[model samples]
Target: MFSLRTISSLWRTSKTDLIVQCQQQKQRLSSATFTVHPYKLHRIDEGPSTEVTCTRDQAINYYREMTTIRRMEAAANALYKEKAVRGFCHLYTGQEAVAVGIEDAITKKDAIITAYRAHGWTYLRGVSLVGVLAELTGRETGCARGKGGSMHLYCDRFYGGNGIVGAQIPLGAGIALAQKYTNSGEITLALCGDGAANQGQVYEAFNMSALWKLPIIFVVENNGYGMGTSAERASACPLFYTRGDYVPGIWVDGMDVLAVRQATEFLAKMCRDGQGPFVMEASTYRYFGHSVSDPGTSYRTRDEVQEVRRSRDPITMFKENIIQAELVTSDELKQIDVDIRKQVDEAQQKSRTDPELPIEHLYHDVYANMIGNDIRGITPFQRHKHQNTSKPCNITI
Candidate 1:
C-alpha cells in the first residue's frame, strides 16, 4: 500500500509534468488553421475563404486583447451601477472581436471612426485602459481631458466616438478623401450600428465613396438590435451589406475573430490598390442595453443572451479552439485572466478617484484662428476672451 504523502507527491509531480508538456507544445506551435463560417457575399464575385489561419503569437495576443476588453467593459458596468460613470455609458461587452480583429489586420496609419459604443475601438486604437476608463469617469487624465466624456475619446489618426447616429458615415468618407488627396496610402474604416442603416446620410456617404473611388470601407456592425429596437422590425431591408448596390459587400461572422481578421486583410489590400469603398456588415451582438440608462432585458430575454454566451461567445469559442489545438493550456489562460482582472481593477480605481479637469479649461480648444475676441458666454452679460493657441490652451471664440 502507498502512503498518503507519497501519493500526494506523485500527483504534484504529474501536474508539473503536464504543465511543462503544454508549454513545450505551445513553444513549438507556429500557427493553426481554423474553419469559420462562410461569409455571405453581395454583388461580389468571391468572398474570403472560410478557412482562416493565425499564428500562435497572434492567437495569444487576440485572446489577451479580447479578454481585456471584456473585463474593462465589466468594470465599466460596475462603475455605472455605482454612479461613477455617467451620461451615455455604452459598454462593449460582446462585440470585442470586431475591434481586435480589425486592428490586427490594419496599421496605425489607417484611420477608424465608430459610433458611441466605442470603448473597445478606443482602446484598440492605441488608447490605454487608463485613458479610456478615465475618460468614462471624467477624470483629468482622460484622453480628452475629461471634456469629451463617454461619447468622445480620440487618439492620433483615430477619431473618437460620435454621439449622433449615422453622423460618422459622412465623416469617415471625408477622412478617406483626405487620405486620397494627400496620397497618404491609408484607408478609413467607418462603423455604424444597424439602427443607422436607415439613415439617408449613410447611403449618401456610400454613393460619394463609390463615385470618388475613396479608399474607405463602410462597416455596419449590425448587432441584431440597436437602441433596444430589433433591426428586422426597424428596416424594410435589413440586409445592410447589400444596401450598397454598386459597392461589393461581405457579411462576416463577427463572433469569429479570425474570420474578421481575414476579411479585413483582404479589404485593406484592395483599398491600397484603389479598389475600395466596400461594405462589410459584421453580424454581431451586444450583451448590454443601448446605454447605462436602458434595461437590456426589457426587449431581449435573458435566456437568449445566455444561449449566445454558451454557444457562440467569441472569447470562449477561441479559447476552446486554441485549447483543442494544444497551443495553450487552461492554467495558462486562467493566469492571464487573473492578470487582466488586476490591471482593469487598478485602472478602474484610478479612474474613480482621479480629480476632474479644472474650470479654466471649460472653453479650451474652441478656436484655431480666433476671428473675433470677447466671445459671449451663455448670457450676454458674461464675456470671455479668445486667444488662438495650440490644442492644449484655452480659446473661447
Candidate 2:
C-alpha cells in the first residue's frame, strides 16, 4: 500500500478546488492506509490520438466559424441596443465549442435537433449568415422565413430550434428511427440545455432510444441554467451525465474544443457501430441571457461568469492548444479573425434590406397542405391584404 502521507499529497494536487476538500482528504488517507491501489497520471499533452485529424485548415475553419458566431451575436447585441432585431434571441457566445466540437464528429447526412439557443448549430451546418441574420430581423430570407425567429431556425437535416422544453428529444429519436428504417449510415444528435434535463420528455426519449436501439446521441449542453434558475436548483440528478441512467454517458470538458471533439468522436463512433443510445454531458457556460431581451448578468454574478470566461473560454483554449502544438501561428489566427469580421459585416448589411416573408410562404410551410379550417378565421380580403404587402412587421408575441 502507498503511504497515507504520499496519497494525501497526491489527492491535494489532483482534485479540483471546488471539490469537498476535507472529505476527499479523509477518503485519500483511508484508501492509502487500507488497500493497495494502482493508477496512472495522464498529461494533457497525451491527448486523444485523433486530435491530429484537426489539420491547420480545419483548425483555421473552426476558429473562423466560432469567431463569426461570436461577432455576429455581438452585432446582434449592438443592434438590440439600437432597437433593430426584436423578440427572444439567445446568443451562443461562450458555448460555441459545444456546437462546433460536436459537429466535428458529424456529417451532412447526420441530423441535429436542438433547443431554442440554436444559431451556432445552424451556422455550423452551413446555414448562411445572411439567412440567420435576416431571420433575427424577421426578413423572409431567414431559415424559418422569419416566422420562427431565434427560437426556431431550421435547415436540411437540422430539425429545429424547438421552444417546448424537452420536446425535441423525442423528435430526435424519431429522426434516428427514420435513419434506422432506411438503413442510412447516419446518427441523430439531440441537444438539450441544463435546465431541460428535468423535463419528463427527455427521459421518455431516453427510454424509447434504448428500447429500439436507435442511433442517437443525447447531448446536454450544461450552460449552468434553465432560464433564471441554476441546474443545482432544478435537477435532483445535477451530475447530468448520470441522468440518462439506462444509457452510457460521457462527461466532456466542453470549454476545450479538442476535448469536446475527442469525446464526441468517441460517442459518435459508438453510435455508428450500432451501440444504440448514448449521452454526452458537456460541461459548458453561456455568456448571454435566457433570451436577448434579458440581461444575463442580472441573475448570475459577473465575477463567476468572468472566472469561467477568463479560464475556460473555448475559443481562447482552442487557439492556445493549436499554437502550443505547433499546429498554427498567432499571425495566421489574426488573419482568420479579419476575414471573419468582414464576412459578418457583409451579412449584417444584407439582413437590414431583405424583404419580409411573402403571404404565400406563411401559409406554404405551415403544413404540407393548407386546409380550409387552418385559414378559416382570416377572410379572403384580410388574407389578400397580408399577401400583397412585401414586408410583415410585429410578428413578435
Best by lDDT: 1
lDDT of 2: 0.78
TM-score of each: 0.90, 0.80
> Candidate 1, clashing residue pairs?
none
**Predicted candidate 2 versus true structure: per-residue lDDT over 1-397, tens digit per residue:** 9999999988887775537776765454331111111111111122234333456666777788778889988877776667668877788889988788888878988999999888888888879998788888889888777888888898878888998888999999999988888888799999999988888889999998999999999999998988998888888778887777878776777776666777777778878899868888888898878887777777789899889878888899778766765557799899988988998888887778889876565654444333453443366555421222333332211
lDDT of 1 by residue, 1-397 (tens): 8899999999999999999998877666777788998898887788788898778788889999999999999988888899988888988888999999899999898999998999989999888899999999899888887889889988877887999999999999999999998888999999999999899999999999999999999999988897988999999889988999999999999998999999999888999999989999998899888887788899899999999999989999999999887667899999999999999999999999999987866675566566677778999899887653345532210
Which 10-residue window of candidate 2 scores lowest in summed lDDT? Answer: 32-41
Candidate lDDT values, in order: 0.89, 0.78
TM-score of candidate 1 versus the correct structure, residues matched by position: 0.90
Error of 1 at 388 (Å): 8.3
